[model samples]
Target chain A: MKIAVVGKGGSGKTTTSAVLARTFARHGHDTLALDCDSNPNLGISLGIGEEATEALVSVRDAVDAGEEQHATSMDDLVSRFGVDAPDGVRLAVVTAIQNPEPDCP
Target chain B: MRVAFVGKGGVGKSSLSGSFARVLAEAGERVLAIDSDPMPGMAFSLGLEQSDAGLPDDAVEEYEEDGRQRYRLREGLTGTDAVEQYAQRAPGGVHFMQLGKARGPQWNNRRQHFGFQRLLDDLPGDGWSIVGDLPGGTRQPFLTWGRYARTFLVVIEPTPASLLTGRRLARLAETARAPRVVAIANKVREPGDAERVSSRTGLDVIGSVPFDPALADADRLGKAVLDTDPDGPTATAVRSLVQTLQKSEEQS
Candidate 1:
């Protein structure tokens, strides 16, 4: 089953989400989760070990990037680009825009 | 163990959450972190490079599942396929994932498609742990996250405004009849901060993370606080918090 964790910013929404997801998986559920907020951090929360979450290219961004050579459907979109999360959890996220300020708000 | 974190803005929830994950990993537990916040910086906190961290170029596939609007990876791909192919591997063995972000001129059109919803529906069968970093505020929770998880964890600061947000979040979770609703007193500057938050919100403060300048500095420097200072006060508190959470899990 899928679960969504919601909260205000800086409230530990991502951290709780990460703990819960791990708890579920450790309990033997092949969990799948996605970051739905505008300020995405679930990748880092999950411990992907990267300095930043891989901002998945959205269909709209693909079209804007001029990579949509042909009309694509959801089925093909993920098969071609869906990211493989650790421990068998699949992840799909929207694209991240480059922000100028490096500081947290 | 599926839980979501919620609270007001600037309460240090993300940093605490990241530290919690690191602590768990140090304890040899596998973890999956989901960043739902739109601002996007958990990776930096997790010690991931800004350039290397981000979602894939093609993260959405909009379509109809059973004659209703739905979203997921290309139609035929299983959730496992998505995990194996797309999930980015972060430090400390934690698997990282994110929802699609709307950027540029097509923002309006992109917002209309709920690809993230589709993904939540198609999550693979469980085994490893999952953590979701939700957006800041109650508005986003109502959009589609209200009933998604069994547990609701509210993180708040000592301030009245943060406590107010926590109270609202508790009410929201209660209205939804979630199995678990708890709060964490984060960035506590005084002795009674946790008690004050608990007394105000009527939700037990499961953990209290102290104010740590070192951690704040790490954040400002764009580095994971744990990576910057694993044995610091913040990390130490997170470790204890993790233990408390684990014990609670056992009791329940």
Candidate 2:
């Protein structure tokens, strides 16, 4: 069950996402928790404050290369939506924006 | 003509937002609620099928690569047109204007404030309440909303962790000079949690909702709680919130 929680910054999203991921993982799933925060703060929410993982694949990179995804339909995108969990859910988190709008300054 | 709902993640931002738009629409407002998150929600959460109608990547690249930027703000259209030229309507009476990941993404991410501001200023005034559902991060909207939206409704959870983040967001909202800023709390299982969090952060706890299992169950079933459990406590709480917001705006 790959689930991606999307909202604006400061919305407790990363923490909620982290907590949700942990909850899913503990429910006997091999979870692939990805933090696409760009600044990446899921660590503290998931209690991995000191440890980290590579930020997930960026939507920007895929588009910049001019590669067209075969599932070019919004319906396809909708069907593929699920919580980012391993085993029970093979979640591929896409978190990078075309331009980091408020560009991490 | 645009009302933006922004807040910490999982702070009932989306729920409050959907209801807010719904209330406005029910009251005869021309509501054009938009979900701009690349992660594609709001539709399901709002009980509407999603739409892919918006700018495509290859199309954007073609315009940019050919040195023809469509969507111009100040100088008007020089080479290409604006995003509204190709905007698509989603189901449930909402016109969806998506800005998907571009082909060959914007190279200038850092300090591109002027360009970003102009882009936002250029959005077509379609005579509809432009209710935007932004991405779950501060970086994107801080730049865009500062130039685009005048009113900001932020939702927060009453937890220690959420309040800490909410404080940071309040300061940011103040600095950006958002014309109006208000905070609402979601998942309020404990009594008095909203007050404590609001005081600690020095921001108004405009609204608060008790955590409802009805909402959780709806999400588990991949259905919108609003449509599934309209009579539940969660729905009542959201209704109260919408009324509160409307009253505040009236008084202002």
**DockQ values for all predictions?**
0.09, 0.13
lDDT string for model 1 (B1-252, tens) is: 455666766776567666666667667776666666556566667676652322343666666678875555565765555555666777887767665555555554333235555555566535555566666655435335433454567888876546656765776565645678888888888998889999989999888888889988998898998888888888888888778877887787
Estimate, for each residue in B17-108, the C-alpha lDDT of model 2 and write its tens digit: 66566655656656656555544456555655555544443232212436744432334531114334444443344444443322245754
Candidate 2 chain B — worst ten consecutive residues by lDDT sum? B109-118
The TM-score values for the models, in the order shown, are: 0.65, 0.61
B149 Cα displacement, candidate 2 (Å):
2.5
Q: Which candidate has the top score in lDDT?
A: 1
Candidate 2 regions exceeding 4 Å error are: A1-105, B56-70, B73-92, B99-126
| Top-TM-score candidate index | 1
Q: Which residue runs does candidate 1 get wrong by more than 4 Å?
A: A1-105, B51-60, B65-67, B108-113, B140-143, B146-148
Docking class of 2: incorrect
